[model samples]
Target: MTLLIRFLRLILGTGVFVLVFGGVELTQPETSTRWAVLGGTLGVLLLLHVWSSPRRGTADDPHPARMSDGKPQSGRAKRQGARPSELAAALAACRSAFASVALFSGVLNVLMLAGSLYMLEVYDRVLPSRSVPTLIGLSVLVAILYAGQGVLDFIRGRILVRIGGALDEALGARVYSSVLKLPLKVGRNGDSMQPVRDLDSVRAFLSGTGPTALFDLPWLPLYLAIIFMFHVLLGLTALVGAIVLVLLTVYAERLTRKPVTSGTQAGIVRNGLTTTGNRNAEVIAALGMGGRMAKRWEEANRDYLAEQRSVSDIAGGFGAVSKVLRMLLQSAMLGVGAWLVIEQQATAGIIITASILSGRALAPVDLVIANWKGFLTARQGWQRLTKVLTVVPADAEPMAMPAPSRHIFMQGVSIAAPGTQRLLVQDASFALEAGHAVGIIGQSGSGKSTLVRALVGAWLPAAGRVRLDGADLDQWSPEDRGRFVGYLPQDVELFAGTVAENIARFEPDADPALVIAAAKTAGAHDLIVGFRDGYETQIGELGEAVSAGQRQRIALARALYRDPFLVVLDEPNSNLDAEGEQALFQAIVSVRQRGGIVALVAHRPSALGTVDFILAMNQGRVQAFGLKDEVLAKLFPRPQPAVAAMPRLRLATEEPAPPLGAAAAGE
Candidate 1:
């Protein structure tokens, strides 16, 4: 539509131009006027094409598609908002810069002909006439042409720099968001920014002469044709050399393909391990396990280096061969031209010119062989970015149902960690209504965290369904679901920001009153106030400045910021002291009393004090589930009366009833 509008606007302007300027021309010439006007118009249109080609850049589109929601989207949905046009727009300035470079390159290549032409003129014209004036004039003109080439070269380089910066600005944030959103359970490589580094490789190649070499390649035939114009024998010889070099380029690539692939894979693994290991520096040093870890990383690193070195060796050999072949080709062309001249078929001037042009013709091919590694890296990076960014989940529109009341129903919702086939939660089913407090009791690794993740739509269930308020959880858009659902993960991480900022979930313009309320509700208000700046106190990344208990409280406060209708807590009190635990217990019960469903994953019995019902999980399957007491009894079973002791007071003891209030309370 934009292009159509632009074309229409151009046509309208042209009509106006005809009305304004054609009054005399139309009357004067039936033959030449229109053509003359068209000639001028063609030049104008070409200028416009160069000037306004890309539509807009960061300056104009204050709202680019790749730059998503004001707040961090945190996951794959970060890529959801990115439209193809946005990426193109982000690169528009760079592409326009390249286009200009291409234009200058054309002029530069033409100027390259100045040296050849000057040589020809010296042998064919200046020397024959013995005209020093003509020689001086030619020298001045050649010097000007060389200077022009140098200027164009400098300008093109500046354009590429601008392009690189623009591309980085456009894509960096999206890449960061996508990385953060990626499921934690993804493969080892997932945690590393290999793709991001791949982006860097792409930008580095683009900023270099790789692009210029590509642009120069197509003009090879032009140089070769000029050689043919001089003498058929010289041209044919040069053409054969060119073909041989082309074949050699292909052969080198083929020979080096396996090593490149192996090296890249090994490098990703090595980098991933190194990044993961470094983040645990304290642990590695304290445990004294650095030696073993270093050995493992060294093995991977060694494989990568070996493969890369092998590729480099092969490529280096091919490069040397190309250089030698090029020199031989130049010498061979000169010899062929000399032979032609001896036969009185060519001139001395033609020999040198042909030799030079032949070298020029082979330059791009040599360049390809020389920079093959960077080219391959850029190619892989491009492919990786395309594959990753093209991925998008089905855009499910949010259900317009009444605000969720936290009636959750789970049926056979099996789950497996991302990038793994083993099931973490197998056919787990449960149902809970609003105003209910449910506890999930499980041993370590018994799928508590995995289940909640699936429940919150972070990772999909491998089978069956999870429903909220009678609608499939997948039916609701993440944004819509997020408005009412809150989750506190097992590993609580607070973003680097002020206490109030964390409590408000980093929502800009967060109401002070609401922030205070949330903090108070989670028992975090007093703790935050104890800091130097109260709500304004800045927290370090991952809340490293605070105690573990404080971090959990802050995270819990973040969860309750909006008074969500449903809350899922995966061992929320794991880092909390007894006081904090009591606060968490009260918060869960209070939320339940207010018609919010709370699913608390508990390991300690004390934390389950107020749960209305309990689900006991063992071996990824639900062992028992019911009223808290009923489930516990089934998990433990009834102790049988001893038959030998049945004779005396044992029978009376068996008949004796426990205290009614305490037994019924199930506390």
Candidate 2:
């Protein structure tokens, strides 16, 4: 659409030239010749206008009112609108590319004006004999200049494209850098699924149209100014047309603001859906709830579709209105031009030139409108991205590194999510020597995981402090803190790569021997060897192809690879079967034996039976803390009695209460 509009602009410029000469001839004393020129020029102008007008039936305009069925029409697709730093970079590139073009273009416009004056002198018989050689030379020079312009324009376009590519890289880099430092909760924002959809939209604003707007910004204004110089009144009229068109573009942009916001919110919903689906996929499959899950997915998807329709409708309506306004302006200019000629305030030549220049002046504004919405949208995306960029990570600091110490201690630690009264963990205090194993156990939502997370400095306690050696955890630099602490969440995730690669995710140049040693210590080496490719075998998405036990082991291996002084494991043995659980328990003991402080959450008594100490929790508060056996005895003195079996009547009364499986399945 942008290219077509530009092409029309050039053709319109040519039409202006022809009309100027033709109208001048029409003012001559000879009626026969004057009528012929006027007729030919008017016919050509009419044909060109019709040819240039956008068609209603094309794919570009598949549905005048909407993009698809049940979707609302886009207000104006053209109005579809970048990052601030990115926009700045694009603007710089554009200015550089257009400098030479603008300089030469000005020269060419002057030459064109001179040539028109010379022709007028000849028509009025002021010049007795115009030299043909001089005219021919000027023609050749102008042709060559224009040809050079064509080449320059192509080069400029290519340069702009290259600049756009660079800008995209910069934008992506900025996002990645910010993401790496973001708090896990913030980085995990938009739900995991949202990144799949919203990231692409972000890229579009970055790579596709963001830089293009910056490129056209220079040319559009220059062209408009040149048209304005041809005739003051016509210029003003064209300027007004441009302004009105710009206003329409602004109105359309305003209309889309709400929809764009809705779209972003919808993206959040999709993220939630994705997280929900991922967290529940196994349950969905095992329970045969595929149809229900599909229905839920469908509902969320439909909501997204509806939001998209709303956005498109706003854009399409804007486009329709803009087109109508442009046409109206075009007609008005020509009609007023004719009137001026009839009143003798302007010559026929002047009238034709003014009309042509009017189109030229208004054309860039038209093109601007087409890209305005895209530019605006890009800006909004930038704003969203900028919000991410501005969020200071919890661990960002002034670069002073805390002194390394083997002592890990928490003093009156109390943690909670922001703006919430629900405590995640409260007034938890403990001290661990350089080498020790501590087991934390609680039912779900008892804050066992939160305690470990806080210990590792993943969660900032609202009150109290985590101290390493003598220095506070917040006093440590990010690198120092990361190097000292390692963590494993309940559910482990593995990227698509070799076992060795997954273990050394952050250490690109990690030794294969080191990776093997870590895997062995984490008890993942045997499972890795069982694969056909051994350690080189690729893991599928989230390591879904691997058993939960394997995933947990791999996570342990990753933590082992870090070789931190403190390892915080949230349910390291939760996914493991009996044998796998034994292996993980051994790994925990081995880490402590090797002088690493190990803190693991476990509910199963057997899994944590060997730990040095037990921290029993209930409802975010510590219930008991002492030697493992002592704490266990205090928490549960004896097992609760089993439910008494109902008496069974002889002769198999009630059909033996059905099989347990049958009864459960039936329920």
Candidate 3:
């Protein structure tokens, strides 16, 4: 399994990084003939990578599985809306670029031989023979090789930049949506930003010099082999040095990984706390808890700093060891080569070339040790983002569907808070026909909000079905359904846009007629037109500069703007005064006039007065459902029924629950 994954990674762009492995063959005194063979092998690997496709190693995958005979086998069909996983496929676009870069890296490694070869020729042939013509020829060829290497290096860096950008462009939206959908409890450290932040880390590592150093790593072996060709003793000396460096690299990772990981976790917590503090800055200031908050932040930051210090200590130790070993290894190789010369087993030229090769062999190892922290971060980031990448919907294109009518249905629907095991709502059922407004009254935690979320298809039901007419709610394309469904949450959230845009729900090309009608229906038209820029006046994210009542009125206008088939308003008039209450009642009547179904989660009588039906909830179940008057009378008696004949309905006497109404007495 490990080998398969490694091979897959190579095919996806790690190929360029592995090109350095064949570079040892370049330092030989031979001509361009030997270079061709090693280059040809990498070329073949590139070709194989280009032609390959990833396959799932399981039988139950929705994508077609492969048979033992190497032919395709049919599996269960995939969901109609979901597509096969394309995380790898999207990344594969960079493979060809990496292949080209690999070839360039290999050439550049070969060009490095120009320096050693120039010295070898001058020492062996130029000085003794006094050949000016040969000297000039070698100098020109060496210059050309160096120039080519420089040009290739520049091109390779530019290609890496483009690869990083392409990866972001290919997956940015998908990853962002995935992160948004993730519940807060799903985060590793309760920081919901991990998945998206992980992608950024991955991109940074790919585009940074870390990958370049890693690619050079494979060339160490080639360099070692060349030194061995010079003399057995020098080769063995360099080989031993390489082994020590590799072991040191492994040891450094082992020593520092835990501390670095702890530091990262601490950092995530610090950042999350900082964000929370900023978000509630007003509350903190009003409550005068600044000192306490600062102390808490300092404590979290101190833990992070301590962990980072431990990692730094380990890194410093490894770096010092790696530097000393590498320098000694070079000096030792020279001594070994010199002994061979004294014994008449090698030439003086062999001593210098062998020393240079040995030094180059250890350079990459030391470089990796230097950048080990960043490399470890990139690895962890990849692991953190892998699952989300696989699960993110690569294809969100909607299917063609006719518009939905106002008839709605819910049959035994159940719902739970995301990432929690207990259900917040269960066995709840209701139906609404056109030209009717339904009201849901419940205590604060009575699942009214959860039911509304399920109705809008934002939360999928765990047990039952929510449908529009005969079609399952999940079957409808979100884009198509969005046109017919307008939902206003209890908080009355708004984006940064003009008043008109907010009312039009930030649609770029909003219909003027619909926008005007909705604003008028919600009693916001006059208020907006009176603003400095009228409908064009800017609104803050939290509707800053606008009163809470104004924001609620604006949200109500947004919900009513599209003349949707279904409208859901959660506590629409919660922050409104008597006039705003009248406006909300009028808006509910407007939805009824348009032959639409409206579901209102409300606590105030003004918000519930216009509704034709009432559903009262307790805990997670529907305790009463009937005409508004019938449910109200059942919950609250005409005058307090006689002791023996009292109503048996469960009624919430807490804040926000509607008290007994006069309509209940006559009914």
Candidate 4:
């Protein structure tokens, strides 16, 4: 199959090359050669359509997945072949659409000759014969052809738009998945939204006139070939103009690449700042730091605008030059054609036809120059998206595993912060069976939160394994693992949705009963019911409509939803009052009672009252892990007393002999 495809490609490519070069020969009469060229062009387009069309595998082709070398592929190799990178897969999916677009472009370009041909007929045929009916028939035929051109052009545009939509449909989810995973792999860089914007840019460019300009560019050679049939001098003049415009397009690309790239970077920075500011609007406003923040944003915006202006100036300048040069070259074609006419080398009709053909040949170049900025943006977006998708490949779905109802185990688990080499938790090993709850205690900056993050699969271990029921955590897909693990980070954030949706983790088909159950377990049922809309109350972004403690309670409810097997909460009670703290204690106890394991990181002693065990950590290392009271005893041992030598020690320390005179002098 591979050999057959290559052979066909070679044959079609050779035919196209031959037709293109052979069309340049002007020895044949214009009428015969034009018909031949037109026929050959259509044939070439048909061949191209055949060559570019996607081939599907069939049952009869047992070795359809074989390599180009004709070897049977291994299972792994077959899998890899079947699963291409996200971007490549998306483009491959659009192959049929693109081929259709190409065919439409060819037809449109052919119809573009209607105007030149009409002028030629009016000047050479109709005027010389003085036939009104012939002219009328010619006009009607040209009108029909023009109408067909318009229809094809509209269809091409629609196809391009759908192609953009198709690409987005195929890759949008994968790109969003990459966006979600990027922060975990690279830490929060404040530019997480750039990948999404890049994808939008590519889609927008595809839907716009930029791609139409690109499609029309390939037909420039065909136009020049037609002009060559008019006269040799006219052909050379048009070719020279095409070459000059091509050079200008290249120069424009070179000149604007840097500015476009810089502008994109600056825009990302400015947007990042805006997002950050908006997220922390309350802090900025309360601290009276709005002016400073605005100043910073203004600086970033100014840089972005400057770079954008530079890109615009380059594209605009080159576009103007290309337009003027095309006009000049068209006039030059007419002047040259007139000279040929004066020399009796060509007819007068040839002058107007050649002039029109030359202008048509250069139109794509001018359009490209005009849309150069968008082209650059789309190209750069493609490059960036490729990098991002490559860096974070799609997650492989693992075999289904049973729900974890046993112990959670960590074996020599050393964890480093994402995107950094420094280990935050070193060689941490522990285990907790069902019906067990462990409280992690440590000083500030210790590895408690980091360890909990790893336990809940928010971060992977640098070296070692986190297992549930003897199976590695990675053996389960994210969705499956999430079903077995619940995590509440130190900073609680809720999405913009109804209260019930947030409590249900935004599950489209979530059970209302389970949502209420989880909320009740978190002791937030009454609080929610007190709201005007109760469970259906709308929550603003980041749960800004709710108090901090309320957000924490809702997050806890989310974590508790569906009653995951392993629950890890970091600083869960930091914002909870005494009542909220009591509710947290009850929630932990409930998890234990239900045979679920829990790992709670807390600084407050009250938060640990219900835990069965304690894991003490210090300076990125586990200090102790045992029964709660035993570990606490080791961490804070009772102070020893010096009972026998107390009198002598007191006598040496007491300097009460400074009498009244010394007291008066001091006074």
RMSD of every candidate to native, in Å, equals 10.8, 14.6, 12.2, 8.0
For model 2, residues 1-667, the per-residue Cα lDDT tens digits are 4465356346445544544444344233442243334335434543553464334312123222323443322323324422234334333333323342333233333333333333333333323345454345335433533553454345334444443444454345545655555545443444543322334455454444344444444444554564455445656676787788778877877887887777667757775777777778889899998898788777877887787788788777776777787787767766776676677665555555555555554555565566655665566666666555556323346567644547788888888854355678888888888778889988899889888878887777888888888778778776667776767888788887777788886567889898898888877888889989998888877787788888888888888775778888887777888777777777777777767888888877776765788888888888788787788788879989999999766694444557889889998
Better of 2 and 4 by lDDT: 4
lDDT winner between 2 and 3, please give it: 3
In the range 511-539, model 3's lDDT, one tens digit per residue, is: 88889998998999988898898888889
Q: How close is candidate 4 to the true structure, as a TM-score?
A: 0.87
Model 3 segments more than 4 A misplaced: 1-85, 184-189, 390-398, 640-667
| lDDT (10s digit) by residue, model 4, range 333-397 | 98999999999998888899889988888888888898889889999999999998988888898
TM-score of each predicted structure versus truth: 0.80, 0.72, 0.82, 0.87
Error of 1 at 172 (Å): 4.0
Select the stronger candidate by lDDT from 1 and 4: 4
What is the lDDT for 551 in model 4? 94
lDDT for model 3: 0.74
Residue 483, model 1: lDDT of 69
- What are the runs in model 4 whose C-alpha is more than 4 Å off? 1-80, 641-667
| Candidate 1 local distance difference test against the native | 0.75
Candidates 3 and 4: which is better by lDDT? 4
Judged by TM-score relative to the true structure, which candidate is superior, 2 or 3? 3
